[model samples]
Target: MAMFVHLTAAANTPRIRRAGIRADSRGQGGVRGVYCFPVLPSYTLTHQWLRELARFGPKGALSAVHVRLDDAQEVLVGHYRDRAKDAQQWLTAAEAVARVAAQPDPRGWEVVVPRAIGTREVHRIRAVPQVAGWRYLPGAHGTRPCTCFGCRIRGEYGGRRLRERHPHPLDGPPPPVPVLLARIEAAGDPGDPAALRDALHWFGLRRRGPVDRLARLAAHPDPTVRRELVWAVQGWSTPGVAELLDALAEDPHPDVREAVADVRTL
Candidate 1:
């Protein structure tokens, strides 16, 4: 959403607005006159400007969302490699970018701060903005009545409500296993299939971005992930995916054999 600006010095013009002064370069008033690398504008400025422009332009219009980080104070990542809170900071920053920076304008974001891990595996859980499209909800400033997951669950269980959210927050947590599995069957790529698959075997719910994880599992060097992915695909496999799994029947791993057999039974 940005157009290149080319300005040449006419007579009294001494500075160019295209580039900014850097550490190596010197600036007199607002005019920067020095050669740091080779080009008039360094790559950093171009990248930074592009990011800035994207924030202000229509490209980020669809990314507007309200992310509420619930219990994001104790996320542990690379505990053995990195320190303890490294993953927590990374998760917090990522949520900020996805909710604020990635969007066209400033808006609220739902931040789910997970305190404990039920399993040992690394599940890079994130909260994606599920706000309605701009066409559907014009000038939405994240103050609309939400239907968050906590409300829905409490309603289903016929219990008292705990969180300040709607019964169906557009970006609530995720649905339960059976419900999520049903949703996956209905929509393969609609609500994040890969997330559903990963949660199916472990977390009991769908995740943020599971498609890439599912794809990686499908193409994993290990046999277990590939084999499990076959069943994962069974719930929502297209013809192309079936063909891909069919080719895997020739794998040397016996688990692949078992997985292919399960597919035929399905």
Candidate 2:
């Protein structure tokens, strides 16, 4: 999911042999992707788009820049040290290439198929973000997956839950308890750390009455259930919780105890 690619120690004085979004014509069933040739010596090209373009699959346009190596020599030497091959490498860099080179038709969008238009900045374009926060968002240094599948699922849960179920906002109440919980639980395993965290976080906000009955297992005897109970209870802002926290705050296990203490604070 991370595409901060081809920046080699040699890249300090990187000798950009060749870089661009391209379609390769070599294979029987060529794939398209963004490619960089003769990458910083010893540094392998792993960005999937490059390989995809090299095979001429659905690839973007070629837009890359070049540089001459100077102080970067030492950096390249060090980067490839781990690899068995220790040698010099380089590739070609071309400029002002085609973009299929044209403007697009707006009204014909759904009916007409499309080809990519190359941009001078094409090389810098990001992959289509598959999941929220899975991108190297602007202003961030290193890229990390900011959202897990569970988190995305939870957001979807929240969206559907908050939507108007009937013709008017007050036409009917929100979804029933069993229906709503089952929908959330269907998003993924409750045992998943992210899923559990989302479940506990959301239910606290809805605050459905007959609360314990609606969230039955939320107060079950099992330690896992107890942990979730503590997660939700700590967020309860109203009255009568001091007694509950008191019994839980000094519980046997550390995690449960911590959860109890957290609930007390809430």
Candidate 3:
């Protein structure tokens, strides 16, 4: 019986047989004349239509909907079993994703999606919607709404277990530098390295920022945070930043000292 299901799936599974679709991590698609956009794996139709499409006839084709987010460099993907199956349910779901992508300031969305394709696998996008007025909220980076199928499954696993498994918030936007710094300070013993890492990254994104407050963190006991500070201070020649780097050069950790000395020698 299991063999029968496996044998039948080959014919009914909506396999993408390489109609010339490619994408890099930066959401650049269409290496060939065929235009494509990045697809979010969780929204793909494979899971939704696996059983239904398999039970249908063998001539069905899989359809993919790619919604280009307002970032232009970002995209959301949705998949369907067949474009014309079950009163167009697959297409409806795909269009719903596009509508959400068009909304103003969508919140609690997944920044990273499940990866469904590999170098050996061929994935194709059949539809690209012209969505507009979509918003990207930086403050909402770490929160994913429970509506998504992936989130539903996760919810079944319970919150405490999930929190234990993933110490860092998996969904949501990058927090402001000040908020990140506050998180680091509040983290206390058995420190939250992730918070410190994010704080450093946030600091690096700005050309000018709170040098004094960040300078105070130079005294943080964690060598990792101090090392990140060293990296972030590079290129800035301000006296405070320079003095901080000099102090870091005397760090007990070899890695921290090395990072402080690694000023752009190029």
lDDT of each: 0.35, 0.34, 0.43
Best by TM-score: 3
lDDT of 2 by residue, 1-266 (tens): 11123211222122233333233222111223322222222222222223322222233332223222222221121111123343312211211011111213111000000111133323343233212111122223364323332322223333343343322222223346565466456655334454454455545544432344324444334456557656655545545445555666666767788777665564
Please write out the lDDT profile of model 1 over residues 1-266, one tens digit for every residue: 11111111122122211222122322222222221100113233212222222223333322211122232322211111123333323244233333333444322111222331122211122122323223112243365433453322323322224233333334334455456546445544433445444544432223322443345445456576567666555554234656656767777798987888877885
Model 3 TM: 0.32
TM-score on alpha carbons, each prediction: 0.24, 0.26, 0.32
RMSD of 3: 17.4
Candidate 1, residue 5: CA error in Å?
86
Per-candidate count of clashing residue pairs (backbone under 3 Å): 25, 20, 10
* Ranking of predictions according to TM-score: 3, 2, 1
